[model samples]
Target chain A: MQAIMTLKQVNYQAENKHILHDINWAIPVGAQVTLTGPSGSGKSTLLRIMAAMISKTSGELVFDGQPIESYDPVLYRRQVSYCFQQPTLFGETVADNVTFPYRIRKQPVDHDHILAALEYVGLGEQTLTQPIVDLSGGERQRVALIRNILFLPRILLLDEVTAGLDEQNREIIHRWLRHLNVDRGVTTIMITHDAQEIAAASTLAKVVAGRLEVQA
Target chain B: MNLAVNNTSLFFAAMLVLVALGISLWQKLGLDKDIIVGVVRAIVQLFTVGYLLKYIFRVDNVWLTLAMMGFIIFNAAWNAKKRGAGIANAFPIALLAIFISTGVTLGVLILSGAIRLIPSQIIPISGMIASNSMVAIGLAFRSLNSQFHDQRQGVLERLALGSDLLDASIAIVREAIRTGMAPTIDSAKTVGLVSLPGMMSGLIFAGVDPVHAIKYQIMVTFMLLSATSLGSIIACYLAYRSFYNAQKQLK
Candidate 1:
């Protein structure tokens, strides 16, 4: 498979301290890649670099044969989505959060599509009107995930999004991710510490002391 | 009306400071030193400005008038910049906002024939405009810094979802503008009912008719409203961009 994203000699430094050192990686198209690392191992930094949420101090980052900087940032981000580890749902209610993707794109809100996605995540139609403060941790994560996929992206970057969820919620999220990867061919790069998730990933990478090593 | 303010009357007026100093001593408020210093500073500063204004009014040269206005505006911008410490290029942003707000307000007053272009008129009105705009810009900068820091997650979420900088930060920007303009708006709403403004009271004390003083006070009110609104809007729109980098990523 051809690589969808490539990074060469990526280095990030802050206050003269190196955070990510000499990272070189190629993410193949439609691949489900899991990144595992100890805390403060720079996994989130690498993901953010790929998402273009932060600039690389020195590196060549290419997405789809073009330099990452060449694309308009807003346009680039639409195709490469990033989700936070702590789910941040804004606005007044669930509908407000879910409808944001469409609102930004200037597309009319698709109620049926929203309903279907909500149901798939085990949320009911009434969840749309539910206040965001009423949501449980799992529900918030699910809503956040559903928000990202409402307007499908070429790549989905998850930063320990399933952290602190109960087993049932984790299983539901994992199943949904698998469906998206296998059935819909959405390339996924997830940061996880879950042993089961790491074991199940076909392609795994580990970051130790700011260096990346691929583990088959 | 007794308009005589000779050295004797001034000396008697200065004695009023003893009342405040005595209260501080009785209450053990630790404000006695501050009260003394404040009285001394006020007397020295006011006398210096009084003599300087007399000289400027006597000279009455356009360049001298402009130079004094520039000094006032510069001082206001410098103070406002201190409130915007962490924001990039905060000083220049504040300077521009204060300058434009002061210039536009004064220009309208002159062009509308509400006031003459003499140092006696231009200098005092310019001081009011610049100082008010300075305060508004400072408040706007403070609001922007705090909101951007506290709401970092919300901004990042929007950015990650592909919203542009303007869309992502519109809520914060509006809130900041409101924060800056709130004091000016509140004062406008309760102008005469709450207290007599300095300009109006001074004019009335100097034997101008109460009706005429009221008209000048109305003009001041209008001028301030215009100046503060322009200053707050300009400062917020410019400062919000500082939170983002050239690549549109939050710094």
Candidate 2:
């Protein structure tokens, strides 16, 4: 499979503090990679740079053979999605959160597709009509996950998506992520520290002291 | 004929009421120093302006008239810049808002012969416009800051989901402007009922024709509303732009 995303010599520095140094990686299409690291190690920062939520201090970042800066940021984000650690749902209803991709794109709301996406994440169609404020943490995370995939990004960047989830919900999320890779060929790059989570990945990478160490 | 000397004495008598207010504040709220200093500062500032305006009106040099107008606008903007302390180009933003609102309204009035460009006509009207615009812009900054703080998560989410800054903040910009202009709109709605307006009362006190005073008061109201609306919109736009950094991050 061709590389769907590539970062070369990426150095992220803030206030002379080196967060990530001389990082180089290429994520292949349909590959599931888990990035493991200690707390405050630059794992999430790398993911953010991949998601274009932040710019690298110095380096070349290419998405699908084009420079990241060449694409419209909004359009780039649509193609490569990022789900924050703590899911932030906007507006009142779950439907609002589910329908945001359409709203932002100025496209007609695909109600059937939204429901299907939620169902794939183990949420029933009825969840769409409910208020998001009342959802449990796991449910909110699931909703956030469904929201990110509704538009079908080429690559998914998840930041410790299951850190606080119970085993039941964690299994559900893991299953859906695998399904995305297997069925839709969605490239997944997740920042996680869970042993079982890291073990399931086809490729593993560890970040320590501002350097990326890829392990198979 | 117009009780000019008597009114001057009455103005001093008004100071006694202010003193009473200060004393009551001291006795009841322990705000003695604040009230005394505020009242004294107001007296000194107003008297100084009154003397300065008297001299400017008599001088009749066009450049000096324009220069005084600039000074008044600069003072108004300087006060408003503090309201948006974090906003980049805060002072320039305030200056632009004051200039546009006051300039556009005065331009129309001069064109229509409703007012001349003389110091006497320009100074008082410009003061009214600049002061009201300053307050409106300040409120715009305050509202912009608070709304962004409250909607931070939502904003970032939108940004991540492929929405540009303008798209994300359109609703917020409108909200800030509306909130900024709300006081002026509400005041306009309740004028003459809840209170006699300042210009009208002052004109009537000066023995101008009641009808003429009412006309001037109406003009002032229109000018104030227009100034506030325009000022708030400008300030809100500038304040909103300040939220994003060079990397388009909401810092």
lDDT comparing candidate 1 with the true structure: 0.93
DockQ of each: 0.79, 0.55
Sliding window of 10 residues with minimal summed lDDT for model 2 chain B: B1-10
Residue runs of model 2 more than 4 Å from their true location after superposition: A124-126, B1-41, B59-64, B107-119, B208-218
Q: In model 2, which residue pairs have backbone atoms overlapping below 3 Å?
A: none
Provide TM-scores for the models: 0.92, 0.87
lDDT of 2 by residue, B132-226 (tens): 99999998888888889998877777777777788778778999899878988999898888978889888888888878988887888888899
Docking class of 2: medium
Give a tens-digit lDDT track for model 1, residues A1-216: 699999999999888989999999989999899999999999999999889999999989999899998999998999999999987898889999999998888899999999999999899999999999999999999999998899889999999999999999999999899888999889999999999899899899999989999875
Task: Encode model 1's per-residue lDDT on B141-196: one tens digit a residue.
Answer: 99999999999999999999999898899999999999888998899899899989
Question: Each model's number of backbone clashes?
Answer: 0, 0
Q: Which candidate is the best by DockQ?
A: 1
